[model samples]
Target: MLVSRCKFTGISAPFSVGAFVKHLAVPLSTRLHCALVNAEGGPQSRAVHCPKFQALKSHQKEQLHLYVDALLEWNQRMNLTAVREVGEVMERHVEDSLSIVPPIRDSYLSRCGASCGKISVVDVGSGAGLPGLVLAIAEPDWQVTLVESMRKRCVFLEHAVNLAGVSNVEVVNGRVEDIGNDSCFREHFDVAVARAVAEMRVLAEYCLPLVRVGGLFVAAKGHNPEDEVKNAETAIRSMGASLLQVCPVESHGPYGQRTAIICLKGHPTPRKYPRSPGTPAKEPL
Candidate 1:
């Protein structure tokens, strides 16, 4: 299980097979092959699974492999994910995103309020489409919009989504706030996702307006998020929203614990929301 955790963490350092099991909680079996250290800087080491994560889930393993291959090949010409290697992509990008699936799905269901099965999703500030692409690949039934304002990143996202052969994913070149106000997009999605974008207050403005009254805005962030959340209270309340939960994510790879702040809209957002392009960044609320 410890090795499983390391697989999720994407540990990069190398070590002798015996020393690995001694220090870490992973199973020590003659079948296990090699040990690698954490790439993100830590003495914490990880033993490579003998058969790798592929063996565990043979059915969909090939699809995951294909996605990583696409990401790496694309990164060479156009930037996609920060972690360039295959192992890092699987653990850090894949598992890390999947860890939040439960909340995202639940939040989607709550928004649908009886439509519990599948729903549409909008990934705001989808740089290289982190959780958005991952979620689209994992749940093909749901439609996902990859909203990005940067032209180059949008090009990369479009290429990546097309190359992945993921019919459910669409890349939109525009700011979240601008998209949220569009007549076609206003209150159009069941769930909205943002990862490492702006602070909570600013994110609320960017995301809340896009979701229907009962929909959710899920903000993915690093370990400590209290100050960001506290700072967003006014924006959250004023927007007819409330904090649902601050879900702590147990890191599966080199990174440590993460957090996903779930905010729910209690009523329709005021028409003034999103306040011109850089307004949220200039003044949070």
Candidate 2:
């Protein structure tokens, strides 16, 4: 396995905002000044004015800022994400991640009724934590597990989680297929989500097994997924899930319109599903 050959970088000390700022590539004074300006909702602060960002509590906003700083810092050392600039990161990554929150909440509400409570969410193929860590930071009450096959990405996820001081998240350095079959994880979560991970058919195989019956499986995809959703109908049913909705998300930036393919897990997934590692992507369903 990749993890067997990979080395882990442990963060020995507890992470703090001050400690994190000092470690950034930019000068501390400049970084702090920029942070202050954003906090004050200056003309340079686009994220602060974003409706999704503005909806978060004061501390949640700060945690998100810390997460962005950590992501940018780590990206310099490793290929965490292609979006490099701060504004782009907020719009493309952070805002894009936050877009799925409503669908998840609505799904939870429609199924369980009343409040969302403490939901368990797993992000399959969570490269650099995208919606996984961002979800954890936004809704601290929910438990989020990030499943990433790549060891280096898992390392970056751990670092980001620590830096953001978010305790609701756990990083798993393993493949979804393997994790899906594990008794401890199979059908264990209330919700499973993936972003730009795979086609709908393949993603259904990878994510549906980890979701319990009556839970939700959300796939974040590009706008206009009608064809992909139509193509994946057979696979979706085979995996014991049914397409619930293809909700459109308001574009946060030039990344363009987005969609959340929400599926409802009405029954348990077949045991042989997800196939072996890389099989789902190669053979699909």
Candidate 3:
């Protein structure tokens, strides 16, 4: 039987008056800042203001700052993301990543055992570790594995892992298709998550195989996704997965909408899944 052993701590933080005035380029509000800070570490973790970041736990907010800074720096050399300013990182990158918590928690609980101990999760095609590293940093218990096909991105992922001082995370340099078939990877994880990687059908092929029976495959999508869900039904079923639910996610204050498609693995994935790296992308289902 599937169960939920995962614990999600939502970080919440608010900006002070001085912080608001400094980032005049973006209309920063104390309430929104507070919501995001809280969302990052949750209400109980810690809270921080500029110059001095105080919280129940020291270093989470600072760690968040460092990760954002690294992404911004690397973005200059490679086009990782368009969010240029620091404020944008808090809104677009940080909050956007954290918004998946509800769906992730709900899906896991409905399926496998509670999210405790070394609950495994693999992020397929984790370009710069969007939800993977972000989730790892927030919830320390998850044994997070980030799989990346590109060499440069893998290097950046390693740097991010070390910078974050996260011991529970690992970076695997390979295509999702190749990694999924490895005996060690097939049916190995409690959850498999992908964000902005591809359409649902294509992603199911790349992700579902890595999830054990009764585990979940969560696909993070932007905006309305009714049609994509419909198109992926056949592929999802073929991969021994069934769509369990679709959860809508939004930032606490004036944030955009995000969708997470939760599919539960009903049986062991076919051994031939995750064909060639480009095959799924080239021809979904």
Best by TM-score: 2
lDDT per residue (tens digit) for residues 2-98 in model 1: 1111111222332333453244332222111111222333221221221233233443344444555556655665556567555566677666777
What are the runs in model 1 whose C-alpha is more than 4 Å off? 1-60, 108-112, 276-285
Writing each residue's lDDT as its tens digit, candidate 3 over 92-208 gives 556667777667876677566675445898888788778798888777788898887665666567666777687778877666666676776789898999887887878998899
Candidate 3 residues lying further than 4 Å off, grouped into runs, are 1-58, 252-255, 274-285
Clash statistics: count for each candidate: 10, 0, 27
Judging by TM-score, tell me the better candidate of 1 and 2.
2
Cα misplacement distance, residue 107 of candidate 1 (Å): 3.9
Task: Output candidate 1 Cα RMSD.
Answer: 13.4
Candidate 3 lDDT for residue 82: 64
User: Order of candidates by TM-score, top first?
Assistant: 2, 3, 1
Highest-lDDT candidate: 2
Assess candidate 2 and give its TM-score to the true structure: 0.83
Show the colliding residue pairs in model 2: none
TM-score of each: 0.74, 0.83, 0.76
| Candidate 2 deviant stretches above 4 angstroms | 1-44, 276-285
